[model samples]
Target: MKLEDASSGSLGPVIEVIQSILNQTGYILPALVLFIIALAIKYPNRLPGTTDPKHRPGVYFPPGADPLIGHTRMIVGFGSEGQFENFKALSDATPAGSWNVSFLGTSSMTFVNRPEYLEYIQKTNFDNFPKGSQFTGRLGDLLGVTGIFVADGHPWKTQRKQASHMFSNREFNTWVRAVIHNELDDISALLDNVTAKNGPGKLILPELMFRYTLSSFAKMAFAANLNCLSPDPDSLKRPVPFAVAFDRAQAIINDRFITPGWYIWEKFNKTGRDMRSSIKTIREFGLDIIHKRLAERQDEKKDPLAPVEGTKKEQLKKEGKDLLDFFMDLTTDPEELLIVVLNFIIAGRDTTAQSLSWLFYELMAHPEHVPKIRKEIAEKFGEPEGGVRLDYESFRELPYTVACLHEAIRLHPAVPKNGKAVMKDDVIIPQGPNPDNLPPVRVFAGERVGWSDWVMARTPAIWGADCEEYNPSRFLETDEAGKLHLRNFGQWKSHYFNAGPRLCLGMNLATYEATAFIAAVLPRFNFEWATAAQGQKSAWPPQYANSVTHPIKDPYLVNVTRVKA
Candidate 1:
């Protein structure tokens, strides 16, 4: 029996109640499972794994933890940003070979960050790792098992193929670049206001970068704009649909580490306690569009850009059959498109924004790099003759700027720590004998095999000892004569885009969004960190597991002073 059936056995009426919920929601399996798990958790004597491990060794936990909460106190008390420090400390403290990460109960969930081992897990024996219940189950209600983020085997394969063909086209890039240019004056205005106040400055809030990227994503993906001009005003315009919901979903996912806690009890209420309004907003927005679009498929034959049978002029004119349009074209299931778009929006906005924000922070932290970046920007098209945005080809040509951006991604991957589960009991990563009293350390069918966020990026094996350094030079090649080469610095050891078949589909889209936003912002002004911001540090773990990695903890309050030179 699945956890949903097994856990919710006594809530006999729950089957129908949950089915009704499943009907109302987009992610059927996950919603049903959430409710079922919620119902089941009320009685935990029946919980699994109470019995001691077959091999009784002293303790599977790490060294310095308090016997009671173990890492929970640090994780929960600290929040997401704090956990980054904790991980850094633990990583630095632990020597490579075999190390243990302490969880709630006994066995310390082992974390190995060496390169050769990292390669095995992420590639050589890739399928052995997949999204386990620890991560996916909690998000199931929100994501469902339908999309690429959750789908296994063929479903995932199809999701990849479809996205590659439709969303990755140059046409989408054209649309995105045009949207960014269309909004160029608006973004420049913000930079101008800031620069006048503080000489040269940048907005440290990843939210700004997020909005820029999201606006671009909105234009391309949904053909709508979040209207993210002024923060508070734009926020009120549509309420943040994607941000908080994703955060809450991720927080709940992270709560699993504490165990015997909130996850299973979240469903019995009118709405799952874990459900954030933003998740609903995002779903509603996407589904409403899907329904209206599907309801008028007849017009698709008439005019690709003309009004539908009954919609208004502006609506009628938006007849472009993008993937989202294709999604409407393909599935009647409510959760399907919403879930797909949910992941897509999350993928596009958060990651790109975070990357850009941190890149700026790095630039501000090292004012020297700004000249190099500015020179790269200037060399391409000379100076942007007054208040103008650099076009697409111009944006792509700036190699050093792209290098800085990739370097930021390497240091601070937005989607840090992706979880994957093994479909079978296999040696996914290289297997060495457990010291003793360990659970054989095999990559099982349903477990969070590893946290890939920083491991691969910082692997010495991948980028040498400089893996931990914030050098953009790694991404920019220098010829034997010391001349700078602009070769594509595409893949790094870090799975920031999550290597293998399950790589992020929005990679190119995000690149375009970041480049466009940067081209618009870089030359306009300089930046400085807020007193409390610049690399503030993670306050996580105690906060949530499934959170996006970004620079809020270290966000700078920049002055976007207009350039006089």
Candidate 2:
């Protein structure tokens, strides 16, 4: 008899026997459970056909992957502190440059560590490997389907085209410059006030950087002035509602990535409720700004030459327009407007703040490099005594400052890993040593392919033996005469800003802002890591919290004193 027919025929008798045994002694049930637990513990990845050494015809999966669950348990076991450790393990396991594994026993994931494969996925076959629905669906609740980050296909292309136009505008660059200068001035004043009140003030740099970037983006992109740097009692008491909501929404959205299925969270869970609430708060904030901007734009259209009677246009030229105004000209859909605005804010704010925080941490750790950066800035922009106003042209001259920012980001990239889902059956040719002379790995449709900037940036094969060290000088090359010169390693090799069609539109703006801020701050303040006592050793490599962007885990406390030049 066939197994199915035999099982069906014996079901009633088997149930009767089990029930009779259970009725007789409940202790047997516990013993059976213990036996199963022992078996699982002894052979975690021993599921049938998973550990076979034989290579499959299409793709090669590493030997240790569990047949169903994949590496989920191992990843979760590491927690936040050991997250990078787990990624390192995966990277080491994929000696042939790529490997396939099942996630949650439902979806197939192919991780690619080679730059050649990254080029293939992001550029050569970009259309074939779009950010598929699964990736978008995970972030849809928070980001919606309208923005470039989560958008795919025609919608993504349209958004990218529109954003590219706006970013390239000369007027937009001027507006960005004005916003950065103003925010940096505010930060300077705040620091001065702290120093005046208490000699050598201690500061949590990450928090301050976040506020600075948030306020800067708010003023430049949206016409809202969120006084995030204000020191007044009233301002301190009343926090920016939208800022809080946006942060909470991001946290909740990131949680979804590690969570299992949609039904588990969406059907009956507090996480779903919290997500909806956070999105509502964020949407409401974006809509309010959109409507306000729309009205202002309508007024301008009625009388183009008549300057708006306020400080709103202070940062913009008579003919200049903010991003929202640009979007208003394109589409009047509020949802679309909100998505675009939020997307820009997130891209601008989080990445810049995190990058700055990491830069400062590196500066504190390696104080010897500080004077070199300061000397370069002072030579170009004069001393930051009265305060330095960095414009588009002047900002480019401080190449050392820019190199420091790049080095920091290389070490601690904001968006460490980026994923793209395969829309068709695509084959990736291995670029590394194929000991088995393995053929091209055939990736199936619906499988997710990704590249980890965190892993790739630190790989010895790509960046050499000293890749783990924080040396900005690596970005600089010595000529035959032994004079050092800066090298522009473009986004393709860097991978921090990503590459191909989806390259970060705000790359220029982010680089300029970071460079300018460093120029402005370094000349005015004597920075050092805060110590428990004057004679004690300061904390060197700060503990960091792992996320899409790796931020310093705790407040990066630093002692700041006004420099006497």
Return the top candidate by TM-score.
2
| Regions of candidate 2 where Cα sits further than 4 Å from its true position | 1-64, 231-238, 305-319, 430-439, 478-484, 532-540
Ten residues in sequence with the least summed lDDT for candidate 1: 45-54
Give model 1's TM-score versus the native structure. 0.74
What TM-score would each prediction reach against the true structure?
0.74, 0.85
Worst-scoring 10-residue span by lDDT in model 2: 47-56
The sequence of per-residue lDDT tens digits that candidate 1 reaches over residues 1-565 is 6646744677657676766766778597786787667644542221222222222232133454443233445545445345655555555553442334434422224455443454566567766655545545555666766566666666777777777777656655555556667655666765555455434544545656666666666655656545555423234235455555665655555555444445446556423554655467656666776676565555656765555432222432433334566565456576677777766665676677778877777776667788887777777666765443666566457778777887878777887654455566554334343232222244333323455456556656446798777888766777899777656533334457766566677776667667777776677665544443443333321122335444355333554555564
Superposed model 1: Cα runs more than 4 Å off: 1-61, 64-81, 92-98, 101-108, 193-204, 230-260, 268-276, 307-321, 332-334, 386-396, 428-446, 455-467, 480-483, 486-492, 530-548
Clashes of 2: 0
RMSD of each predicted structure: 11.5, 5.9
Query: Per-residue CA lDDT of candidate 2, range 3-112, in tens?
Result: 44554675857766766777788778858888777766654553322332233344446555553466565544544566765676777765544656655522666777
